[model samples]
Target chain A: MNRFKSFVIKEFYHIFRDRRSLIVLFGIPIAQVLLFGFVITNDIRNAKIAVLDYSKDDISREITNKIVSSQYFSLAETLNNDKDIEGIFKKGRVKMVLVFENNFAHDLENTGKANIQIIADATDPNLANLLVSYLSAIIMNYTLDMNRLAVVPMQINMESRMFYNPELKSVYMFVPGVMAMILMLISAFMTSITITREKESGTMEILLVSPLRPSQIIIGKVVPYVLLSFSSAVMIILLGIFVFGMPVEGNFILLLAESLLFIILALSLGILISTIANSQQTAMLMSMVALMLPTILLSGFVFPIENMPFILQLLAHIMPPKYFIIIVKNIMLKGTGFSYVWKETLVLIFMTFFFIMLSIKKFKVRLE
Target chain B: MENQVVITSKNMIKKFGDFVANDHLNFEVYKGEIFGFLGANGAGKTTAMKILCGLLTPTSGEIFVGGFNVYTETEKIKRSIGYMSQKFSLYEDLTVFENIRFYSGIYGLSDADIKMKSNNLMDKLGLSAQRNSLISSLPLGWKQKLAFSIAIIHDPQIVFLDEPTGGVDPITRRQFWDLIYDAAHNGITVFVTTHYMDEAEYCDRISIMVDGRIEALDTPFNLMKTYNSENMDGVFLKLARA
Candidate 1:
């Protein structure tokens, strides 16, 4: 026990002495979280749009009012001629342009048909698609209300109800992702680099020559990192709850327990990486390429795994953070307990065992 | 073979696939003697030392250290012996006192025993004043000495020194030999490997290896007379050339 204490103390000294490691462990998580939450979001608001009404009629005017009042778009200009559309779009100030046919009210009253053209800048396809959807929904709702007044009805309506996040707040989604990423960085990447540093410096040979068993040595190296990652996890959760208004609807203990489990899985990954890397720089590079890329790309932290190709979706299922994100989102948004999360919990357990078994095999081979 | 042998290897072979490192060589070191093992850059002195230290297992044949077989009783042999490599493996971020305490703790020394012995060891090596200083700040010679001292801090029966004096001033080399002599005087058998012929003369008995086999083993004077050489260097060159 005294030996283990001394070993842990040495690990702490290594961590505190390296300033670069300090920043990578603590600075990266909060920066990424704030950037993803505030800077990169899908739910755009207050986009400027231009309108051209060739018809001087009540139907066209009513449709214009409905578009402006929906709050999804704003009228930046009212173009008098068709030539204005090119210049407005080229200036980049207007994201969308609307045109109404010459006899809109006459056509609607006599033939029950009116034509409107909504043209969006297709350079950013995602934004264009969202603008098209929001506008169509608003127009359809207005037409349905008009049909109710006219006695004959020919209108279609579509209502979107976002389930987990009704307000579509980006913070609700990014907070859990940021927490998983930061915990993996601190636990796996940092711990692996530290252990490989010792190996490169020859201090690991000294420790191995001593009477301490290999298991004791490994545990001693990893325990301090587990504690550090746990604290970082808590800090992110608190920031998400208090500062960003992300809900914490589930039991705090369950959230913490899942976080701890994932932290251990990441720590074992660090150990596994140390066995493969001969130098600290090599270990850091490996962690970034192997752990960070997979965690970010394949773990559904940014991109949706369901939309990926089949092979990539299979690869995503093996990523540890995928399961971790599911658990975090479930507890925070769904207020779920173990009964609801047992499948994900079991998957995490299997991944942890896989990493531990591979690391132990590598360690034994190194000992030989 | 002598009955009181501390190290005994009989046709011991170590091979990595087809490359034979220690090839069916036989040698012995008796108790309470400074035995020197010398060879050129790739003559397999390190391979033999690693096998004896329980860090590596030989490919074939029998090897024993402290009367325990390398194949079956490696952990027991590791417990009964100590090893120090030329790398001077000490944690640079740790204080001198902390390094010593850490080694002692892992070696299963009690806290009171560690404190007492660490103080006495540091005082004897004239490093008592810098006990709290980080190992990185100390000179290379001091680090080497501290590493040698810590290697045998457990008071093992035999200590293996694999080129312990690789790079240092002549003064530090002489001081390191003095520590080895001190260990010999206390009945701790010293099995050391070195390239310096002057250091070879200080050993009670010396062995020169050539192509993974010992070509000469005796007192320096006897080997010189047998080879008709003026110094140990001439003898080593002649044997290496043959």
Candidate 2:
């Protein structure tokens, strides 16, 4: 036990002593969280818009007011001529351009036939689609109100409420994803590198040649990484709570227990990786390519798994992060307990057991 | 055989898939003797040594280390033995004291015992001043010497040195043998493998392996006389050519 203590202490020394690893372990997560939260977001706010108001009428004015007041689009300029639309779009600050035809009020008053032009930048197709829908919704609402002046009519209403994240704070969603990513990196990636480092330096052979069982050697090497990953999870959670306004609504102990489980899962994965890799460089490359990228991409940390292609969706089902992210989201946002997260818990448990068993088998094969 | 024999192997064969590494090799080392297992590169000396050290499992064999069966009692065999590989097997990031503590820990030593033995070992090695220094900061000779000291930190019944003096200077090699002599004098069996023929001559008994089998096994003087050669090297060259 004393030897195990010193061995774990040596692992901690290796982790804390290296500047590049220290930065990668802690720096990237926090930076990604903050960047995803405040800088990069799906919700459009204050989008630049230009208007060509040829109608000079009450309907056009009301529609413009609604668009501006919705806070989704800001009116950047009132274009004088149709030719100026291209120049304004080329400037590229303006994402949308609205052109109201001449005699629109007269045409609507007589035959209810008025034309409106909505031009959008097709460079960013997703943003363009969103902008088109937003402008159309505003104009439709205004037209319906104007039609009410003539007669009262039955209408369809669509009422929607976003659960948990009403304001759709992207940071709230990213906090748990960041926690998973950082924990996996610090636990699995770092542990594999450190273990392979011992192997490369020939210290592992010495330990093996000693009285230590292979299981004991692996455990002693991985225990410190699990603890470090746990602390890293805690740190990310604390940063989310204090720095960002991320709320943890579920039983705090359940959340911590789940985090600990995921950390173990990642550490076991690291051990499996180290067993397969002969060098520290190979371990690092495997961790990045096999674990980190998949954890970020296929785990629904950044991309939605449901919306992925068929094969990728099938692949994402096996990624441990996908389940972990669901558990975290349920706990943090929906305030659910084990009853809600039991399925994800089972998947994590199975993955952890699978990885650990695979690693033990691989280690035994190496001893042969 | 109460401490009479340190290691015994009969028809030991280590096969990886279809390739046999230690092919039906028979060997034994007596207690309190320096038995050198000699071989050229890839001659399976390391493979045979690994089996004796409980690091590798033989496919079909009867192997015993310190009178304990290797297949079922590897742990017991491991506790009774120590090993230093071709690469000096010390954690370079750790201090000399830390490395000693680490090895002793795997052997399940108490803190007080580790403290006591480390001091005595360092004093005997003339490395008392370098105890607190990292192994990386030490010279090649010191690292090699320190590796040997830490290998036997638990004071095992036998120590396996696998080319322990691979890259050290001739002076260091002589000093390393002094340490080996010290271990042998303490009634510890020294089972070593080396490519250096002169080092083989210093052993009480030496086995020369070529092509995965022991081509010759006898005392250095007896092997030279049996082969009608002047030195151990001449005998090795003759066996290697054969």
Candidate 3:
């Protein structure tokens, strides 16, 4: 036990002594979360749009008032003719254009349906999709309110509601993804580099010939990183909750425990990397190219895995972070309990076991 | 000096697939003697040393280190041996005193023993003034000497030095031999490998390896006479050439 203590203390000396990576360790989570929260988002706030109403009726004016009253869209221009839409969109001043066809209110009352065109600029397709959805929801809400007062029982009004996040704040989605990515990169990258640094410096040979067992050495390498990755995970969660007004609807303790499990999984990946790489550079490259790329791209952190190609969907299933992100999203956003996240938690546990066993076997091969 | 064996190997062989690294090696290292392992580059000197240190298993041989079987009692063998690699293995980012203290602690030294031993070591190495200085700040020669001291900080039965004096100045090399002689006199067996022939002259007995086999094992005086050479370097050149 004392030998293990000394070994861990020595590992800390290496971490604290290297000032560059120390900064990176604490800096990445904060910077990435803030960037993802504020800069990269799908939230539609005061989206610029133009209105082209050919009817000039009270109902068309009322619907226009309703759309503009919502915080999501702001009236950027009033187009006098339909010919100006292509020109206005070419000017890039508005993300969408709201067009009401001729005799909109007359058509609505007589036929129980009206033709209103919602044109969106597809240059930034995600933002355009979001703009169209919000507009459609507003129109749907207005029609529902009208139907409640009408005496016609044969009208079919379609109503759709966004649950959990009624306002569709993008931070709610990004916080869990950022947590997954930061934990994987910090835990795996740090552990692999530390072990490979010892090998590169030739201290590993001395450690091997000493009284310390291989298990002790491998454990000592990972314990410090687990602590670091856990602390960073806490920082990200706090930022999401306090800074971005993101909610933690479920048990906070369960969320933290799950984060720790994922951290250990990443650390096991780090150990596996260290066994294969003989130099610090190779270890770092392998961790980034093998671990970080998959965690970011295939973990459903940014792109929706269901929307991916059939082969990538299969590939995403193999990524451990995909399950972690699901677990985090369920706990923080959906207000779910362990009963809901149990299958994901089991997958993470199995992956952790598999990585650790493989790394131990590989480490033994290296020793021999 | 010649008969109390601390390390014994009988017909040890290590092969990486079909390539023989230490082919049918045989030797013994006696207690309280400076035994030198001399070899050309890639002559498998490190492979044999690794086996003796219990870091590698011999392909098929009988070996004992510190009276413990290499295969069955590797942990016990490791506890009684100190190793210094060709690269200076001290943590460069740590202070001189911290490196000493860490090494002592890992060897399972008590806190009181650690405090006492590091003070004595720093003073003896004439590094009392640099206790708080990082190892990387010191000169190369000083670093080499400090690494050697740390390797034997736990007072193991035998210290294995794999080219411990590589790339150091001549004066420091002489002082390093003095430290080895002092350790031997204090009943610590020294098993060292070096490329310097003059360093071989300081060993009580030297084993010369050529092409994964020990070609000669004897006192430097006997090796000089057998090869009809004036010095250890000429004898090594003739043997390595053959």
Candidate 4:
């Protein structure tokens, strides 16, 4: 027990003594969270828009004020003629434009129908899609509010509704993905590098020749990484909850327990990688190419797996992050319990056990 | 030297496929003597040492280290022997005291024993002022000597040195031998491998390996006379060329 404790202390000294590793271990998580929250977001505020009211009447003007006052859209220019609609779009000043058709109040009152035109710049397709839908939702809300006061309601079958997240904030999607990514990269990177460093520097020879068993050396090296990655995982969760207003609707303890399972999964993968790699550079390269890229691209973190090609979708199914993201999203957003996440938990547990077994086998092969 | 065997091997054959690394080798090392193991590169020196250290399993052999069988009692053998490889084994990022304390602790030394031994070691090496300095900051010779000290920190019965003085001045190498002599004087067996033929003369007995076999083994003076050579280097050349 004292030998194990001494080994662990030695590992901590290696971790805290290096400035580059300290920065990577603690600094990257918070920076990634804040960057995803504020910079690369889908939520828009005060987007510039142009208006053209051919009707020039009270009802059209009232609807225009409602759109601008919602804070999601701001009026850039009010054109007199339709000629400037295409001209303003070419100038790239506004993301969207709204056109109210002629005799809007007369048509709505008599026939309960009125036409409105929405033009958007689709040069950047995702942003354009978001802009047009946000404008349509604002107009629909105004019409619904107007219907409550009037005796008649408009016959509109198509309605817009977003559940679990009414505002459809992009931060909610990124938080879970970021947690999986940060935990996987940090835990795996730390373990793989630490183990391979001994081999690279010739320390493994001395360690192997000592009375300490190989299992004791491995477990002692890994215990410190577990604590480091878990604390950083906690830091990310707290940042998501308090800073970005993310929801933790599920049982908090279950959420943490699930996170622990994922961390152990990553740690075991690192050990397996170290067993295969002979140098620290090889270990780091393998972790980046094998773990990081898949976590970011194929795991549905930044890209939706459903929209991917058939082959890539099949590839994404093998990635651990895909299931971890699902587990996190279900618990945090859907307010689910163990019954909903048991399958994912089992998958993570199985992967951890599989990697650990492979590592032991590889280590034994080295002895021969 | 006492006529007590600390290490012995009988018909040790370690083969890697068609190539043989240690072929039918046999030798014995007695207690309280500096025994030298010499060979050219790839002459099977490292392979034999690893098998004796209980790190590598032999293909077929009867080997005993500190009276423990290499196959059935590897753990006991590990506890009774210490090793220093050619490459620097101490953690460069750690301090001198920290490295010593860590190695001693892992060998199951008590805290009080570690404390006293570490201080005495630093004082004897005249490095007491640099006790807390990182190994990376120390000179290469100091690091090499420190590595040798930590290898036998637990006062094991036998200490193995695999070319422990590779890249250092001759004066420092001589000082390293002084330390080895001190250990042997304190009744510890020293099993050392080196390519420096001049250093081989200091050993009480030395073995020369060519290919995968021990071509010659004797006292340095006897081997010099048998080969009709003036020095240990000439004796090595005569056997290697044959």
Give one digit per residue, the lDDT tens place, for model 4 in A1-368. 87887799999999999998888789999999999999989888999999989998889999899889989889999988889988999998898888989998899888888999999888989988988888888778887887877777446646757888988899999999999999988889889999999999999999999999999999998999899998998999999999999999999899889899999999999999999999999999999999999999998989999999999999999899999999999999999999999999898888899999999999989877
- Cα-lDDT of candidate 4: 0.92
Q: Rank by lDDT, descending?
A: 4, 3, 1, 2
lDDT of 3 at A250: 98
| 1 or 4, greater by TM-score | 4
Model 2 per-residue lDDT tens digits across residues B67-140: 99988888898888888887997777778887887778778899899999999989987889988898889999
Model 1: fnat (fraction of native contacts): 0.51
TM-score per model over all chains: 0.91, 0.93, 0.96, 0.97
**Residue A296 error, candidate 3, Å:** 1.1
Q: Write the per-residue lDDT of candidate 1 for residues B183-209, one digit (tens) a residue.
A: 878878999999999899999899999
For residue A368, give model 2's deviation from the true position in Å. 1.0
TM-score, ranked from best to worst: 4, 3, 2, 1
Which ten contiguous residues of candidate 2 chain B have the minimum total lDDT? Answer: B1-10
Residue A324 local lDDT, model 2: 90
Model 3 native-contact share: 0.85
Chain A fold similarity by TM-score, each prediction: 0.93, 0.92, 0.94, 0.94
lDDT tens string, model 1, A1-368?
87788778877877787787678767777787778878888776878899999997998999999899877889999998999999999999899999998999999999988899999998999889989988887888888888878887444555678887887787887888888888888999988988898788777776666667778888998998888889889989988888788887788999999999999999999999999999988999999999888988988988999999999999999889999999999999988888899899998888899999999999988876
What ranking emerges by DockQ with the best candidate at the front? 4, 3, 2, 1
- Clash counts for all predictions: 0, 0, 0, 0
Candidate 1: misplaced stretches above 4 Å?
Answer: A53-74, A100-113, A144-157, B1-4
